[model samples]
Target: MARVIFLLVAVVSVFQALAAPLHSRAVTSPQCSQFNVYASAAIDEARLSLGSINTGNDIGNARNILQAQLSLLDANTGVTEIADSLLTSAPPAPANASATVVAGLQAALASLNQIFFLADNTTKAAVAAANASMITALDNAQQAVAANCQTTLN
Candidate 1:
């Protein structure tokens, strides 16, 4: 009976040890958390700017907004790159999530690049269409990061 009890306690201890890391990994690292915050803010800004374009108000001002969002996207890419590097040594889940974030950022950047090239004389409908595409790309990036990284938007 003593040997059985000891074996049971040892097994329980092992299980607890195995479970701890899994639970802890659910919370992202500080770098990843920072990336989440920055990325979320960038996405929000992009959406707001795009909405302005869609509403046909301040079309000229929308260019400035897009430029600002472009800058934020560039900055976010740098932040996520750092997070990705740090996460490389982390567990597979976080590392994969970081990769997803990188891909998403790239997509958003590409979409923004296209939107930025729109001629100043472009029709409102055309501009609105482009804005919609950009918004979709941004939304996808946000969703991918939240789903893959287990990141909570602030």
Candidate 2:
């Protein structure tokens, strides 16, 4: 009877082990991660272009635009910090600014992720297209800032 009881307990433990949940860890920051990378690149490119100009006015405006770009990137970074916390911890609906940004970014990331989960192989291409759209938007915004800044400097 003792041996039979021990075998039953072992079987139950094995079954329980198989029932354990699996968790996937992801570490993506809206600021210092992939986001900052692209933003910074755009800024650098704009700044470099401004520097090649002959007029002081144009240079000044370009600088202002770059500054504005940096500000936007900073805001995104703030959001990332909030998101990082939520990812590692339980969902805090009452999160502060960081949390709020994280939630927003999380939503965006989810949208991007869904493109990957779609059954069609076209999903990845679609995701890439979406990403390109975002990059293009940023680029256009940056260009406007640079142009306006240059005008102000002039």
Candidate 3:
């Protein structure tokens, strides 16, 4: 009888130990991680693509890129809404998301010349100023997203 009871206790201990890891992981993996990852990818795209935009394009290529990114923003908000619906939800990453947002904004600034080429020097200065604001916003957003991921947003 003593051997039987000891064996039962050992088996239960092993089962509990295995189950503990699964429970902890489930707790750690917030649904918002999905949103964070996708959002980061979109931001990275903005960062990488910004320099490639041709300021002289009369065909609205830069405009198209901005529109595509804006569409991504819309999708990201949808993901956030779904994540929010869950109990004990993941953190919404306004902090991390701001970096890429700034990138898009910067792209918008550069795109100003494409929209209005012959404007005065003051107008060009305004565009340059807008570009600076975009860069700051984008960096802040990247940091915020990284914080939410807890492992950096990829």
The most accurate candidate by lDDT is 1
Question: What would the C-alpha RMSD of candidate 1 be, to one decimal place?
Answer: 11.0
Error of 2 at 81 (Å): 2.8
**In candidate 1, which residue pairs get closer than 3 Å at backbone N, Cα or C atoms, i.e. clash?**
none
Best by TM-score: 1
- RMSD in order of candidates: 11.0, 18.2, 11.3
Candidates 1 and 3 compared by TM-score, better number = 1
TM-score of each: 0.36, 0.28, 0.31
Q: After best superposition, candidate 1 residue 114: deviation in angstroms?
A: 2.4
Instruction: Kindly report the root-mean-square deviation of model 2 from the true structure over all alpha carbons.
Output: 18.2
Error of 2 at 25 (Å): 13
Tens digits of per-residue lDDT for model 2 on 1-154?
9999999999999999999975544433333233434543443443343233333333433343334334434435544443454456423212233333333333433334433233333433433444444354355334323332110000
Error of 3 at 83 (Å): 15
Q: Which portions of model 1 miss their true places by more than 4 Å?
A: 1-25, 55-95, 116-154
lDDT of 3 by residue, 1-154 (tens): 9999999999999999887842211121444355444454544454345444443543444464455345445434533432343323344333333344435444444554355452445434534554454455445445444555332222
Global CA lDDT computed for model 2:
0.40
- Which residue ranges in model 3 land beyond 4 Å of their true spot? 1-118, 149-154
lDDT of 1 by residue, 1-154 (tens): 9999999999999999887843222345565466555555655555455445542444645565455456445545544544544445433333344445455545545545554444445434544644464455445445545655543212
Considering summed lDDT, which 10 consecutive residues are worst modelled in model 3? 21-30
**What's each prediction's clash count?**
0, 5, 7
